[model samples]
Target chain A: MQKDFLELIRRASCELPADVIRVIKQGRNAEANGSPSRSALDDVIENCDLASRTSRPICQDTGTNIWYVYHPRSVSQMALTRDILAATRKATRLAYLRPNAVDSITGKNSGDNTGPGAPVIHFHEWSRKSLVADLLLKGGGSENVSAQYSLPNGAIGAGRDLEGIRRCVVDAVFNAQGKGCGPGIIGVGVGGDRATSMIEAKEQLFRLVNDKNPDPVLAKLEKTLHAQCNELGIGPMGFGGLTTVMGVKIGARHRLPASFFVSIAYLCWAARRASVSIVGGVATYSQISQQALKYKLPAVAARKGR
Target chain B: MIRIELPVSEKDVRKLKVGDEISLHGTIVTARDAAHKLMVEEWPKFVEPLLKNGAIYHCGPVMKKTGKSWKAVAAGPTTSIREEPYEAAVMDHYKVRFIIGKGGMGPKTLKACKDVGAVYLHAIGGAAPLLADTVVRTKAVHLLDELGVPEAFWEFEVDGFKGIVTMDSHGKSLHSALLRKSKKKRDAIIGI
Candidate 1:
């Protein structure tokens, strides 16, 4: 199981999901010929190709490992954390991940990629007899651009309704400009406390790029935000062209009466994430994009041996 | 597009203008936040000869050990704005000719570039593997133990590394212009 988990980290780091690749391709096609945006997208596609072929990390900043785990009550959290930490160290040795966990106060790095709160794991217990783990490698550049907005603000004329959310999201994207690596995706959390709102926004990134929102109003807002963000002409790396944003995903949670926070998590085009479910000791890998599974799964053979 | 090789000459760096595409060859050094601070504060005399009139890349590469040697797996540019506080001083002290990074720098760094005959080159931020392919060999490493892998000073012999000149030695900055333009667009979008 540890080896399988290590392989999951390798896959998530080296190969991007199909949905992200699809949207990036669309972004490339949308750009004008001879524009910097087209050239930038070309470089990204080439980088992805090289990373997948060589099984190397897609980006130098392999980023912080954020794991979402769903397991049965039988599985101990301590054991899960231990296995994850071990896998992380192994992954760092393999160069599948960069050592990113740094001590905040001392400004020192934990060279093995494990620190006090590194590889943040969110575990949820389920009734099913299966254990599933999902990993998202959120890079620093995109993470830096993420913003949280308080509603009923006069700036941008934002009010408490959905229109206010739209204004805030757009402003966030605009302010990000090309810094977050545009032709990017936006994950928006409409209602929650400060911490939960940010978490919810980040969670929205786990969804497939083209997946429709379950709620009609949210779906419409997603579509509108997607179009408007692209219209900003921030383009790829802010060189200026069409297709600034590829997708806009929105998720909402009930908020307290006093707080109305809208948090936005800007995800770069890399968007590396992968999942695996172990049911009855049979590990089955689930990709973020269902349409395409082009990369060869090295772990499938390991699972077969089990 | 212009093809420039390192260690870049001051004359060549001055000739570069904003918005010109560039491809670099020869040796360049990688440094980020920690390294920048170290260079500015400690001012390592041992590295001065190697860095003089050379390019400094704002990158924390993914490196793998191959026996005694190291290889770059993914080497991409980091956001340069974070190094704003220390960059001008380091550029002035070291006589660094080229600053290779992504997302651009601020006014102080731009002024230093103009004053010291240096230029800021913008690379594609997430194109790590592609950039790594351009690295021919790892030359040397310094401060690895103290600053960690990403923040360590890694010298590499590169071939045909591509970037756009967003800040020039001639008091021109494409990034600043773009920022102004984008602000106007944003104001119009918000109906301000």
Candidate 2:
């Protein structure tokens, strides 16, 4: 179990999922020829390929370790948590993960990445007699730009409606500029309290880039926001080009009438997350097809000045 | 692309513009949040010799120890804006000619770039392994015991460490200009 979990962590840290690479390539094609944004995207793609090939981390920050595990009722959650923690420690030592957990009050880093709340794990019991694990290595640079807004946000003139949510989303992306590391993917949560809304926003990031939102209203909003964001011209790395956001995902939950909260989770182009399932002692991964992993240089030398 | 050998001068960086692509060869130092704060507070003289007319990378690297020496496995730029508070002071005090980071810095740092005769080089933010491949040698480390691995100052001998000059010595900033244009677009879309 520890070994399997370690591989999961390694994959999450080192590789960009196929869907992410596809959208990034699409963004690259959409940008003007010989633009700096296109060059930046080329460097990004090359970096992902190198990281995946060498089994090295995609980004040095390696981010906060977030795990979502689903298993049968027979399995003990405690034992599962213990194994996950153990795997996290070993991964850090092997340099598959970085020591990122720091003490808030004392300003000390827990060198092995296992302090009080390091490697946050969410456990659930499902009826199926199988186990599934997902890991997200959310880098700190993008995470710092994540925002939460309480509606009737007079500052932005946002009210408690879908329009208000759209306003908040725009404001978030605009504020992020290139800081969130554009071309970014945004996950938005609507209609929940503060905390759960943020969680829902982050959970939306686990969905594939090509997946459509099942909610009709959200689907339309996602489409509009995706287009609206790109029009901002933040481009790749905020160099002011066509593509600022590659994708926008919206998720909503029930909320009280008195409070309406919207949360935006910004993910960089890296978008490092992976999942695996185990049934009958056999494992299957959310695979990255080989063709999607191929690398080529941009038409103009990306490293050369425009 | 412009090739700059280290131990640079104000004149070398002054030639860079907001959109110039450049590469650095020779020794560069890594410092992040804690190290920046410490450097500003203590004004450590030891690192001054290394940083004088040289580059300081805003990076928290992933390193592996091989036998007795260290190897940078994945060293990429962290967000530069986080160090906005101390960056201007660090540059002016240490004579740092290049600030290598991503996401760009704020007004004070931009002013300091002009006043201090420095430039802000925006690295490819998440291109960790490719950037790490440019690190020819991990020369030494400092503050390992106090600041831990990621926050420690790492001295590296590099070849072809590439970036775009987003903020240059002529009082121009690509990031600020982008933000102003982007804000106008956002206002139009949001209608507020």
Candidate 3:
């Protein structure tokens, strides 16, 4: 039962997601002048089409294997984390993924995307029947832009509101402008301590790129924030383009003020990951891709800079 | 718009303003993070010769080996900002005059672009498959074992490879201008 799920992730790691695939295709409107945009879109799509055929990553940055586990039953006795790691090992091998984790100081490659910080698996306990895992293979190009603000020490603004949060998201993307390869989306973590905030920021990516915030206030804030981010003109690949924020996924954690840690994790569209679920010991998957996970991007393509 | 080969000099690059587009015909080498680091470390031995006649493209293509032949299905320009730190040194070491990739180069690369008669060409990001069509031939390769295809040196014989002049030898950058312009419009609408 577990082997099939593990095998699914192995295939997912190398495969581009549908949403990301859409963004990769839509980001190419820059060449609207002629076939450059269309041509580039065709090229990327060809790569995507061949991704499964070639069993190769659509983009080079295969990223870290992150598992967001939502447990169904409060009384569930499954070895939650152990099971995830077991599956991670299998996926890593099948994907032929390059080792992206190792000693930050020694700078040695782990050779298989595994290490102490290799696959960051997070679990949330809930009551239900099946276990659901939102897998994300976060690439380094986007991950390198992660920013942390230890509220009491680093934050410059007082009375944290939508503006303050917006600024943080802006500043993060701005500082990352042309570097983290914007116009990428910034995952904003509002309401939590430093540790909790970091995790929340990452989980926010699971939200659909185009879905609107259910909360009216939050939705307005998100729209405003996204528009400002695009204004940064850190175009396609940060060279300057219309679509910057595919969508901003926000996550919150309840914590005291003193425990507050505001963190922002930026995600480039190349973010890749996928997963399947084990139901009644039978397996089913959403078949969502880590790449081509086009958030709310109006344009559904990302073109290569000619 | 007619695509013509333009040989721009450093002095000419200094005069470029924002939003001017141009197409170039010449030799360019593909390299990303790892290869850039390697070239910086090795300096003369690895970079000098080809750089004299070429440009450096920041790209990593999705490749595959089928029946003893290597083919690129999607070869797109990666983020160029990651190479900012090493670009100036590499450009100076190799005396390069052009850079082609997605995302514009950084201040250091920008400065080098101005000083060395170079231009940072912006390729449409995420169009790897389309760009692959432009690469008529992969004439040779280097350092494949160490870094693999996406990060290896793929000397291509290309015809009419297209890109926008986001950052030119004339010190004009479309990215910065767009950011500044859009930021104001957004601020007004948001009233922030």
DockQ agreement of candidate 1 with the native complex: 0.74
Task: TM-score each candidate.
Answer: 0.95, 0.95, 0.75
User: Which is better, 1 or 2, measured by TM-score?
Assistant: 2
Per-prediction CA RMSD (Å): 4.2, 5.7, 6.3
Candidate 2 lDDT, A180-213, residue by residue in tens:
8878889998878888999888887777666676
| Order of candidate numbers by TM-score, starting with the best | 2, 1, 3
Candidate closer to the true structure by DockQ (higher is better), 1 or 3: 1
TM for candidate 3 is 0.75
Off by over 4 Å in 2: A287-306
Clashes of each: 0, 0, 54
**Weakest 10 consecutive residues, lDDT, candidate 1 chain A?**
A289-298
Question: Which is better, 1 or 2, measured by DockQ?
Answer: 2
Taking the true A–B contacts (Cα pairs closer than 8 Å), what share appears in each candidate? 0.70, 0.86, 0.27
- Model 1: how far is B127 from its true place, Å? 1.2
**DockQ score of the complex predicted as candidate 3:** 0.24
Q: Model 1, which residues run further than 4 Å from truth?
A: A289-306
Ranking by DockQ: 2, 1, 3
Instruction: Flag the better candidate by lDDT, 1 or 3.
Output: 1
